[model samples]
Target: MDFEIREDRTAQGRVKLSREREAYSRLMQQGYTNAQACRVVGIDSRTGRKWRNGRSADRRQKAAPPINAVVPPSGPSRYLTEDERLHIADRLREKATIRAIAAELGRSPSTISREVRR
Candidate 1:
């Protein structure tokens, strides 16, 4: 409770809470119940639960992972295909806007612009 826990803790790096978290994990490994570890560590029972199993909309299950808005750049499937490059070439020759070409190709304008640049 003394430690200020912001709701928006995503990737914030809880260096302040790390000591307590480590102690809680140690207690858990030694067969202490969730409540007992929380009491000893001076954090709330719910905070203990979040530290142990993660938060969820449903209290019984772990939190669902965030949905990624974009494809990861590393995969081959994310790359522009030969046909897509040809389409870009054709669209450029016709003087189509980058956004228009991107919309037609189902890609970002940056992708269309980058292809045009190449």
Candidate 2:
């Protein structure tokens, strides 16, 4: 089977469909929604949907991988440390309130609440 590749131009005649698809995929990978990515790539929302749903007219197999499969940036987490967790546990045993614990640790009450829940 012989396949001839022809570039499909967009309305602006500056960008091609292939380029739009590539941009869309990259945007989606960076946590953009189909519509949002499509807008950024200057393509229609329906086209973005087709790309996301794997119904491309060109029959190309372009699929974005799972977001979790994409490795996150390596850095120190902006979260409570082991010492903070130990302090939280000690405070909890002492029947300290969430707000009080947060005040003692200079953290938000919600942070303490979420940490305790975890």
Put down candidate 1 lDDT per residue, 1-118, tens digits, no spaces: 2433345545534566776777777777778999988887777888777677655677676474322224345433667999999998898889888899888878889977887888
Q: Candidates' TM-scores?
A: 0.37, 0.36
Give candidate 2 misplaced runs (Cα > 4 Å): 1-16, 56-118
The C-alpha stretches of model 1 lying farther than 4 A from their native spots are 1-13, 57-118
lDDT of all predictions:
0.73, 0.71
Deviation in angstroms for 4 in model 1?
A: 17
Write one digit per residue (lDDT tens) for candidate 2, span 49-77: 76676542445764543223245746435
Maximum-TM-score candidate: 1
Error of 2 at 37 (Å): 0.5
Q: Model 1: how large is the Cα RMSD against the reference?
A: 14.4
